[model samples]
Target: MCGIVGYIGKREIKRQLIEGLRELEYRGYDSAGIAVMQNGKIQSFKAVGKLSNLDEKTKNFETEGPGVGIGHTRWATHGKPTELNAHPHMGEYSYVVHNGIIENYREIKAMLEADGVTFLSQTDTEVIVHLFEKEIERHSDLFSAFKATIDQLDGAYAVLLITQKAPDTIFFARKGSPMIIGRNRQGEVFFASSDAPLIGEAEEVAYMEDGTIGYATPDLIHSEPDALQFVSLSGDKLTAQKGGYRFFMEKEIYEQYQVMGDTMIGRVLDDDIVFEELGKTFLEGISRIKLCACGTSYHAALTSSYLFERQAKMPVNVEIASEFRYKEPLLTSDTLFIVISQSGETADTLEALKMAKKAGLKTLAICNVDNSSIVRLADATILTRAGIEKGVASTKAFATQVMVLWMLSIFFAKKRATLDNHTVKEELRFMSYVPKVLQKALDVHEKCKRLSKRYLHGHGFFFIGRDIFFPLALEGALKLKEISYLHAEGYPAGEMKHGPIALADAELFTIALMPKTLLYEKTKSNVEELSARDSTILSISPEMFELADDFILTHPHKHPMLEFFEMMVVEQLLAMEISIRLGNDVDMPRNLAKSVTVE
Candidate 1:
């Protein structure tokens, strides 16, 4: 996914835009650019590589203000990440920055080229600017041009545009892909692809709703009636000043405390976890539920499958998005589809969602980014409030999604009379206290750092667990392989004899996710199976800590329904620590992009 940021104020637009881009560096981009409308003319600068290239290029420009601006960090999908293909695309008449793939833009581009529009770049973003130039000739107002342009669009997109005619205004629209509006101390309004760019610059934040358009200014804004009403805000003074952390990822990893707080913020009231009004019809309408996801989200859904079946007495199927769409799946109108994606722009997941909708099934999406394609297409949505997961290896987002799934499961289970009221009350209370438990793991970070070398050279390591922890094993292996250069396998502890046991040897290091639950002692005994293979075992549990090569402990009061997510978090943190220790660029791993946008 690409990143977009905009500012309309007297403050130096170039400085603010670049500063914001630095904050959002984790979104993963190949090229970066910015455009400011000064003196009724657009001045633009873009670089093919890192944002630093733009920094070097812009060194000659004075930071003058009294202008409107828009900037972009691009992840190439339609074209190579070259200078000619970078964003902040100008169409002789307009400058635009966009986030999602425009599914049918090639066709639209061919039509635009026929109009004598000299194309400068090979990008779907360029097509929109060209189309808008034509649309603007007919309707000059930014709002009207944006409304008409959106009507002609074919796929997921969040667009922020500025033109010579309306240089003071930014026509921001979202059909899909996330875009948010924020307000600053001077009542200045800011818009970005995500909140990371606006966090310390703007205080009051409102996630833009789907099918909504907004006209923004330093001190003015108007949006669709359904959007969040304008609110005033100021940045956190402490974070605004560098906290001496070496990297944003490091600062963010440490910010887990606030992320946990924000997730539970106001959403819990009087010991009850009401999910700030997610329409329950998403849960109630599921005569049957199919959870579709990719990567870490897939593992989270796998865990949810066990929870739904056990706690809600509901039959749930978890399918990887890439495999789900092509495989012959038995479908029915009564089926409910649930999609989980951190960015909500994952191409395969988006396509799978479309297929499910074509089958006439009602759909619900659980996503961290509001206004993403999955969110727009879904009949309903429950948003996880973990703001801007910059780390390519997801930590908080995965945990929060599982937390939401757990809550949703109990909510529906109680609605169907499958769970008792006492059970619901206890899980809610337990989830609220998990932040303190998570903080305990930070004390063990150094141990995890020391534990990396054993896995770095590891020919193969095994992750073994049963029941809910089975998915935890799968997720742990995935995180390790994705961010770290290691060979790993995840298997149900009961399936060791089927084949995995033969691969086990003294050099093999096995990590078992043990918890104090119905399967506690059984899971502990399974550890012996690995130990018998002369494997060095590492166990993470709250129930028992036996003498092994390694052990990580959780607090004593583990929440029955919520423990799965906490352990998943532990493994994710461990995996990242190991990945960083191996000299891998933990945020951007090799042969992989954050979102598999190109099928």
Candidate 2:
């Protein structure tokens, strides 16, 4: 995903455009550019690699006059992340910044080239601007031309256009990609890929729905009222201050306690779990659960299998969404296919949900975005309410998804009469204190940081656990390798001797999940095998301190099912701290994008 911003207001927008680009950089930072219509022509400046490069190019540029402008920070898709392929690509009359692909770009490009229209860059976005230029020639009105242009394009997109013919207006349209429009009391209007840039600047924001077209000017923004649903965003979230934390990742890691609490609110009542959107009848007659997801969401699904099997006494199957369809799963009336995604627009997950729906099986979605594609496709939906997860390595979203799964498991247990009222109350009470218990984990932040430093320079890392904790170990390994660029592997503690133990040595670091349970001795024996090879041991348990080279004590969970929640937070912090110590880009890791929209 790329970040795009547009400003059409009473004030000069050069500085605002730069500031907005910086705020939205988490979406992408491969290249940055800005365009303003000046003297009936487009004034465009672009550079490759980060907003800083564009800032350097515009250092001596003038912004004395008020102007409507649009800017982009790109995560390249159709072309390389070079200056030639940056956004704000111009045509005869328009300069445009675009997010999302044009599936038929080649067909459109070929038709335009046959007409002798010159193309500037190797981007599908350039094709869009040229098509818009052609549309204006016949339509004669900017709004008509913009709408006509969007009608011809296929695939997902959020487009912002500024043209010489309409120098004072900024026009935009979206289909299957996120876009927001905001307006202030002074009549200034702002547009961004997300609400990050509009937080403090605009008084009210309207999240644009798919297939909507709008335009903004210094005095007003014009669009169909029903196409958007406005929401109030806090100004405090827009501030650049990191709340005294070294990085946004660090700040977000700590925000988990609060956000996870938010996810639980109104949903978990006294001694009961409730999803207002789904009634008790929703889970009735469900013989099996098929969970489809990818990456972090898939690990959450893996953990859900344990909860559903043990607590709900139901059979649960987890599949990577990308492979689920290929396997040609046998779907029946009693099967409930659940799709989990933070963005809900994840392509493979969406496709898997579609396949399940086509087979006449019931579908459910666990997602953060209420209006996302997967939510729209599902028969029932549960919102994570984790808020916007900006960091590439997800923290709050994962915590909230697991929490929802546990609650769902309890709900199923109740329906099947497998869980007694006493057990339900105990689990509910445990869920209620999750936020406080997670905060207690943060109390040992310095210990995780210290442990990070000691193991930051290790040659490799090993993460091993059992049952529900096994998936958590996979998640921990993922966080470390993704953020820190470390070579890490995760395995079931019992399976370590099958093959992974051969890789153990003093040069490696082992993080063992040895929670005090029936299998604690087996996990401890796995740690002993690692220690025999002189590997440094990092234990994540209330006990097992004697077996660890460095141990971060986990606050005891009255219910064993809740232990993984605290373990996940500690792993997230350790990954962040290690990445920081290595001088790595903790938020936007190398060659990684936050949302994987493309296949």
Most accurate candidate by lDDT:
2
lDDT of candidate 1 over 198-271, digit per residue (tens): 77677687778778876876556778747576554444533432233433445555656545654554454444
Give stretches of model 2 more than 4 Å off. Answer: 1-241
lDDT of 2 by residue, 83-109 (tens): 889988988778999877776688999
Q: How many residue pairs clash in each candidate?
A: 1, 0
Q: Give the TM-score of candidate 1.
A: 0.62
- The 10-residue segment of model 1 with minimum total lDDT is 237-246
- TM-score, prediction 2: 0.63
**Angstrom error at residue 102, model 1:** 36
What lDDT is reached at residue 168 by model 2? Answer: 88
User: How do the predictions measure up, each by TM-score?
Assistant: 0.62, 0.63
